[model samples]
Target: MKKKWVHIIIISVVFLYLFLPLAATFLYSIAKEWHNTILPVSYTFSAYENLYTDPRFLQAVGRTLLISGITLVLSVVTMATATFVVFMYLPKMERVLQALVMIPFAVPGVVAAVGLIKVYSSGPIILSGTIWILIGAYYVLVLPYMYQGIRNNLRTIDAKRLMEAAEVLGASKIKGFAFVIMPNMVTGILLSALLSFSILIGEFVLANFLIGGYYETIQVYLMRRLNENGHLASSIVITYFLTVAAISWMMLRLGRRFGKTEEIKEKIS
Candidate 1:
């Protein structure tokens, strides 16, 4: 009972922490005018309407989708390869490999972007002022979250035991890993996709600095007009939220389809 109260209190605090900002944004989005008058006396969808009609918003949406799609594919590829190497092999260097995986998070985002920018310029890749740079930046930014999902899914499955069982039955490591382990990690993949999508669609700081006017990601576009246009900015926020909701819902569906029994039970209860 004591523990239950603690959990309840903690959950309450977290709920407030999350919902307050979202609620404030939603309320502000609808308000005609907001000031220090305790509350805005009226609300309207003018902001949302303006957002849809604006050419900038439409272009931003397209760019955001493009960037996010690229990011998702790269994140999935990187996470999948990392999981295979770290979980199935790397017996002697698992710790070292995992530490490397955490490098993206440990290094500051700005520092990493600057380093990458320098390397790309120096190397024969010649990826200056291109979508590739944005995609590469997304690859790193989304790594920590995607890694967590992959690593967690890895932890739940007894990779060694499964591999042993499969090898004895004449299956190759690639076949066994792909056919068996991949299915179990569906939730993880979905989670990684959701997070990667979110991060990519709304990434601003790196996109602004590294991407020199070739491909304007949504966040970058929004930031450009924010000082001059409140309605357009609000529209971007609302539209982004809708995108996030749709992606998250799809992930949840995929997760529940697999053996996410605990999540299902919670929903039912």
Candidate 2:
């Protein structure tokens, strides 16, 4: 009983440590006149009201979503195909691929951004200060997540044996990969996509340096608002948190549904 209570206390401390800042931010967003008190003198929804009514906020959100969605699709397609080929045929190239992806992790974001700007600012095809550049950078940014997630999922499903079975059933390599391998990878793909999207949404250094106000994303907008109003900035943070949470929840539900459907199909087969 003592050990149980000790464990409960430790967990509670950890939870509070993680949650208190978010709770304070939420409180600040709603507080009308909080001054040296344990609680607010009063509360109002004006911060959220103003945020929702702001056209710039909506535009910023739209831009962020657009870029993130496009990047997610591009990363998923490219990484999935590359990982599949490496595992299925070019197994010897796996180490090379791993080293390539790890480059993003080794380099600092600021360094990467500066290098990208320097390289692309005067290239045969300049991508500086454009969404294309951001998309390209984001594609590289997500390579580690996409590659590892899909690779792990492929290993989990014993993709080699599955492909052999598909071959016995008279399916070509392409068809086997498409119909047999890809479906099993749905959960990992969704998870990696969600993680990449969340990171892209919150990322500031690359976006701020690469595009700046030319293409103001939600993070940039939030930074601009932070200097203007504390309440509004707090509201934005809360909203950002909620948006990520909602997306994560939706993706988890979709993954679960996909798993169940796959199970049913397996039982039938």
Candidate 3:
């Protein structure tokens, strides 16, 4: 009992450490007058109102969503297929693929952005300053997440055994992969896509460096608002937090539902 209470206390401290800043920001967003006070003397929704009234904010949000959706689709399809092929036929190549994915982690976003610009700015197929460039960069950025999540799911489902069973039943490799292996991977793929989407939405460095005002994302818009008004910036942060939280909650719910369905299928089979 004593040890349990100690653990609870530690968890409470960590929770507060993480949540207080968010709480403070939320309060600030609604605060009309908060000078030298424990709480706001008066509160108003003007910050949010102002934010909603801005056309640029909406455009930024739409562009960010577009980029995130395209990147998520591209990453999931590419990484899932590649990982499946590697695990199934090219087992020896798994180590090489893992090393390649980890390279992004070692390279900082700024350096990668600069290198990408240098290569693409004057190339025959110049992508610099285009939405395509941002999408391509985001695809690279989320590779590790997509690869690891799908790989772990494949392992958990014992993909090799499933494929072999399919083969015994006279199912070709492609058919087995499409009909059997891919369904089991849905949960992990959704989870990874959610994580990647969240990361891409919050990311400012590469978006700012590569595209900037040529194609403003939500993060870029938020940075511009930050310099203009503290309360409005706080509102942007709060809105962004709620948006991501809602998405994460929805995706996690879907993941759990998929997990349950897979379990029932396994039991039935």
> Candidate 3's C-alpha lDDT?
0.91
**Superposition error at 183 for model 1 (Å):** 1.6
| Number of the top TM-score candidate | 2
Give, for candidate 1, the lowest lDDT window spanning 10 residues.
257-266
Off by over 4 Å in 2: 248-269
- What does candidate 2's lDDT look like per residue over 58-117, in tens digits? 999999999999999988988999999999999999999999999889999999999999
lDDT of each: 0.75, 0.90, 0.91
lDDT (10s digit) by residue, model 1, range 1-269? 99999999999999999888777777777888888776677888988887778787688778878877878887788777876687678756667767766887788778877887888886779776887887877777787788777876676565567678888898998888878777767777787788678667666778887884667667777777667666556666767787878877877786666446445534645
Which tens-of-lDDT digit does each residue in 1-269 have in candidate 3?
A: 99999999999999999999999999999999999989999999999999998999999989999999999988988899999999989999999999988977999999999999999999698999899999988998999989998887887688899999999999999999988999888888988888888889989889999999999899999998888988998998899889889988987897787677668757856
191: Cα error in model 2, Å = 0.9
C-alpha RMSD between model 2 and the true structure? 2.8
User: What TM-scores do the predictions have?
Assistant: 0.77, 0.91, 0.89
